[model samples]
Target: MSTPHTRRSFIGHAAAGFSTLALPRWGQAQPATEPAPRPAQIEHAVTAPVAIEVNARPIPAFEPRDRSRTRFGSLQYRSGLVLTSPHRGFGGLSGIRVDAKGERFLALSDQGSWFTGSIRYSGRAMVGLDDVEAAPMLNAEGRPITEKRLWYDTESLARDGNLVYVGLERVNQIMRFDFSKGGTRARGEVLPTPPAVRKLPYNKGLEALVFVPKGQPLAGTLIAFSERGLDANENLIAFLIGGPSPGQFSVRRTEKFDISDAVLLASGELLILERKFSWFTGIDIRIRSIPLKSIAPGALVDGPVLFNADLGHEVDNMEGIDAHVTAEGETVLTMISDDNFSLLQRTLLLQFTLVE
Candidate 1:
């Protein structure tokens, strides 16, 4: 993870092979979303029409021709690449979701912003991105909620139809926004989080969440996972809320990584994204998928680590993960990194196919 910094600097210069789209021509036909709201207690003055300008560049390689057999547990490389923008507020991305078609995507920045765009691919490898828009998450008053107490660290997101839930880490609260309402008026209202959520360490609270679809084992349930919160038995704590299995659950933590994000597979399994870092080891990331049949009240769920990678593999602070199926009926997992707005780190978007 990039070290947290306080200074603000916007790198507006796009390097070679980069592309940008400002208003009018941008967001022409995409989903309607409000502009970044009036920033609350922001550091810089809001002087531009766009709150966050995106600079996208192409990254054309995944694996070499002779190295097609590469595997990490049950995951095989489909394609992966890096994304970098000089928007000082662009880092700390923690939540992501791709549309049913796997074409459009929505993600949340830990610093309190929303990123939406189309994923560009060349044949099978991700080549670049287009139609990108980054805006601040708005409060009920039509203002950026960053002004609220310890509220900027938006960490987890889940979508159920038009309802979107965002988990703010430091704030230990869930904000609900109804996208069913059109663009300019979809300001958010806070949801009633379980009392257990507020008791977790502020920084490690609510790192991942996913809504159980109507046909799933825990149908209509919302499973919220913490970054590092523990149970009475020292196991990682998760909450089962708003469905048949409403209570507390646990997932065994191994290899010293905390949960970063998670996704619900079509078969009702939970795929977890985790990361670990140390001065000597730099950064390491992994994924573990457990069956929903095994998740219940007080259940200790553990699954084989499906994938693991490090900085050597072009991975940065790989924090966001979501799964989608391609037209060919293959499970493609997409992951993105939170650069923490630090110059030393590069925001990355990666894709892989699960072989098991």
Candidate 2:
């Protein structure tokens, strides 16, 4: 009885190999530091990524006693829309909108003590939460903010709607939450990481936020953080405008080109999503695309596997990606996964159509 489009084609065909992740004993105590600074001009061009065609369908999701564990790491996209959260949950569904108002909104973020509710999208569409509240205790800049600091992953929502950039990751800082400042606790202000990534070591937070479009000469909004570790030597850093305030971020290095589910690909390019599990072989995931001027920081290119799900195709933990247009004009890519509530792990939504 599978049918979420056949469990996303069984997660793109049962899954296979691409292993190389080993660096998380608890974090901290591994920072020789020295790799950051690449991209003088970078004009390399060599497209590959062209093998994603899973429509077998059937993804209801459930398979997480411990398939590795990772509910939500980072993701945010606006207008065309996308948002998520679940690595640990006090508040489950964080944000996800694919508007014109066709309807797709599942928002919440109170993980400080877990009291989220009011997530709607069921009837069979999937995405279900309830209506919880009572977990917010914000005060910052005035004190009284006891723990439950929110630990937020990363978020962005400010083309000009009135700011919404969150990245507390336990408190390295990157606030900005002022939904017009009416009241929701409002307290967003920090913004400035880059003393060589705040000095590295354990401060390891910040996952994803892409805004790009402030003024030129070098505008702003292109954060992308996730040093989780596994390859490319580590240090997946990139920050240009940054905003909020602290020292004003500007670090760099992204040309190493590895695979870890990066985003921001409206033809501007730079899409990386990967996951491959193994018990013997029972999970698969892939999505790749690069062209952000070929990438700069550290400049070390080599990504072109594109799609290879045991060769058949199947997708499960393929977390976040956005770039919609469709109606004939063409150009659609919507993917989401982060069901760490663990029944087995399933909360996926994938749709692709971009080839040029």
Candidate 3:
């Protein structure tokens, strides 16, 4: 297990490698002109889905300094890729949902665009992506959702069968889309939330979402977590919407980390992917495992750290995570990074197997 102090020490050791790097401030807004015009502009021009070519380069090792090492905490590194595309609206991926077979995937950008594709795999290792397409998220009026005021910072995503939920951080709102209607072309409607959800601080609200499906502890519930929303006790505030116990709860805050993305396992464990940034340390990412049965309204939940990585490992602004079970019963976790469309950053896809 990694305590705050131990993690800090690890970061300090990794600082030397990142000293010359100028990393983008994760989650902060930048000028549209700075990043070759905002992605929304490019997406807006795309009224319908457009096929895009995404190029992927393999990451042969998780830690370049230790190529032979495969285990990090409770996870075993499988493979990784550096993803790039010629499409201007391709980066800034903040959320993703992978299918049960770990092939088909649906991802979204903070600029209010949708990306759908399938992963090409060699046995259990990811080799590349194929048949990718990009489209703008449409409103009920069939216009781009970015057309709405303060609606482009779409940060979180959750899926239940054919239904998809998107959380916009700038305005602290969630939108519901029925994929059965039109897939990524589906028009979205606002999903009403608790009053406090709308009151979270701008830029720090609605960062991660997890939809608990049938047979789970919080089945039929959409769990929404703020990036840094704090309660009276200073714990991270989260909401349980449209469930048997629909209300608020807190996740015990530790190590100054904020929630980035989350996934609910079939075995009833909620795996939260979190990250923290500092001028001295660059970026650090980790995963925590919380028992789903322990979550309830007004409850303060905590979990054990299952994995941890720093700039020492292959990582960027990691923001999305999903898990699938192999036919052999192995649980595999996939993670994606939000590049923020900055030339200084990169979009990375990584995978690991849960060893615990």
The prediction achieving the highest lDDT against the true structure is: 3
Tens digit per residue, CA lDDT, model 3, 146-198 = 77777788899999999999999999999999999988889999999999999
- Looking at model 3, residue 77 earns an lDDT score of 97
lDDT of 1 at 120: 80
Indicate whether candidate 1 or candidate 3 has the larger TM-score.
Answer: 3
lDDT of 2 by residue, 304-356 (tens): 54443321322454544545464566555555554433343344554444555
Whole-model lDDT values for every prediction? 0.74, 0.38, 0.87
After TM-score superposition, the amount by which residue 355's alpha carbon in candidate 3 deviates from its true location, in angstroms, is 0.7
Report the C-alpha lDDT of model 1 over 1-356, residue by residue, as the tens digit. Answer: 32221111111111211423211111223235856534442312231124344555543333332254567678877776667655545656777899876778888888777777888877877777677766667788766677575777789999998888988888778888897874313678998867988998868888998889988898988899999998877779998978896888899988788999999999878999998866556667888889998999878999978887765555667779998988888898989887665554567788888887
lDDT, candidate 2, residue 123?
35
Error of 3 at 285 (Å): 0.5
List ranges where model 1 is wrong by over 4 Å.
Answer: 1-69, 86-88, 183-185
Which segments of model 3 are wrong by more than 4 Å? 1-45
What value does the lDDT take at residue 51 in candidate 3? 84
TM-score of each: 0.83, 0.25, 0.88
Ranking by TM-score: 3, 1, 2
Error of 2 at 137 (Å): 9.9
